[model samples]
Target chain A: MVMIPPYVPEAFLTMYLPAIYAGLIVGFIGTMAIAMKREEIHILILTDLVGLAMIFIVSAVGTDLAEALILPGLVVELAETLAISEILITREMRKIEQDPRRNLSKSSSLFPQPFSLDMEIMTTAPNFIALVLIGYGIFLTGFTGGAVAGGGIVLYALSKKARGLPVLILDGIAGVSGIAWCLWIIGFLLFFVAPQYWLLSLFLAACGLLLKVASKVGLIGLLMREDIDKE
Target chain B: MEIILIIAIALMVIGAFGIIFLKKPLDKVIMFSILDAGFVLVVVAFKYLDVAMFAALVDPLSTLVFILAIVKINEIRKNKVSGELND
Candidate 1:
């Protein structure tokens, strides 16, 4: 008699089989939607949803690196969504502007509705929450948290009133942080050459991650400022 | 738990189709939001509570970003039309 050991326990498979099948079905449908849709926005949305479903399926399967990937995966997904949305919005707007009948009022456009009073109030609320996050991050993670919280504050402020010397200061901070991130990456790579530098490399890597986060948040701030100016 | 996961996945698939098929941008955005909810459900089912919380926090920010982009594009289009009229 020959015996084969199951890598995944039969009990485990039984427990999660339905979820696995469901994820597969959902992913397939999303891909099909993308193949069928001609609209840029529609394709973007379907692709994003499909990507999200794939992540869920991967996580459910208990891949060794799945837990570590969840946060970064969500962040990348949002970044991609932002990029696609920006492209689609720009293209649609250009098309509208070029049209002779683009009567601003009657044009059937995908432009977002104007913000309501409630939304304005909600936008401001992020500032305070970000302040708390900064305090907590700094308390927990030191300089790294400081960078994140600082960047977040700048982002919130810029979104609200992107102008003057403050905006210039934010830009300067972003540039500095970007440089710091690059240096840290170099330090991380050199850690293999000198084992003694491992601790320093790790610290710098954390700094680099935080700086990268700050720079991205600051970019969003600048974008918001530009968006407000366009309005 | 498995049943909940299945339901969430089904909702997500339906939402995805709705987003692709819906003609109105507002309706598509609404469907996107529903898909986001389905994502949260899936995360929760996988017992990644922390991830679910983070998704709850970040998903709305992405939606806000999209909305802002849409508003900005509209403003730019309006400005271009006005500029052409003046010219």
Candidate 2:
């Protein structure tokens, strides 16, 4: 009779232990801040910070798994950030509607002044940098690089002024791709339950990656459309 | 490396406190950015250069989104005020 010892994930856990601890501490602090401060923007930032910490903790696996994990974590954070921002904006809009005296501008200096060339240049620079990032990411590690680059493009589009059909289209594409990325993570988790689920997980991951690419391309299409419309 | 991680963690903790205690939204945003930089440093210390790069890329985007949202909200408020005054 041959005896085989049960495999333990101890080594994996140990490697990620510090990250996990940091994530937990940050997450706790974020929650506490939200509870104590009751500020939506602070909550959003803190929660996203926690999410970023979680990415580091989760990606402490093998190099390949780490790469696979990064995108899903990022997509989750991005989606939440967008959703919360929308909610905060809507809430502020409602507040202004109810009370005209509410001085939003006086309250926050973070808001950019109306459509200055410097502001436009600042916003547009990220898109070009995203392209460069995509190029370098591809040079470094093929698909993972592509994923990060695609995310950068999405960020670029999000940072730009949201206007017209083009912005709407990009938002829709980003929302779908973000959901697909989350689904990919779910599928990846399911793969650990049974070896047979590997193919299904791979399919989900591929779809997620394709959707991300589609979203990035959608941003480009939006840009071209804007140019033509301006002409 | 461990020392670097400790420093990063300490920075994050301080940022967290700042976020909770800061009076203004803009101040909180700045604190959040600092916390983000700390997270990136920790990832770099962990030798996950790719993840670190991704963090660096994403951080500015998140900040920009927040700023845009704030700007949009302010625009809506100003427009509404002007509309009311005209009425």
Q: What is the TM-score of chain B alone in each candidate?
A: 0.82, 0.81
Regions of candidate 1 where Cα sits further than 4 Å from its true position:
A1-16, A93-127, A137-155, A162-167, A228-231, B1-87
Pairs that clash in candidate 2: none
Predicted chain A of candidate 1: TM-score = 0.68
Worst 10 residues of 1 chain A by lDDT: A109-118
Tens-digit per-residue lDDT, A1-231, candidate 1? 524245644565554657677778889999889899898878887887787777767776554566556657766776799888888877778777887375444433445434322256346667765665555544434244544554555446545643454667767876887787786768778788887878888777766666666656656666555545433
Candidates in order, TM-scores: namely 0.59, 0.50
Lowest summed-lDDT stretch of 10 residues in model 1 chain B?
B53-62
For candidate 2, the per-residue lDDT at A105 reads: 40
Off by over 4 Å in 2: A1-5, A11-124, A136-147, A156-208, A211-213, A216-231, B85-87
Question: lDDT, candidate 2, residue A53?
Answer: 66
Write candidate 2's Cα lDDT for B1-87 as tens digits: 688988899989988999999897778889999899899988898799977877887787667656655555656578768766776
Q: Per-residue alpha-carbon lDDT of model 1 for B45-74, expressed as tens digits? A: 889985576566556565665675565666
Best by DockQ: 2
lDDT tens string, model 2, A1-231? 533234535465456557667877877776777778766687777786678667766765535667678877776676678678879977877776676665544433333334322246345576676776666654543346545566556555544555576566657777987897786677778788776879887676666665555565446535532432221
TM-score of 2: 0.50
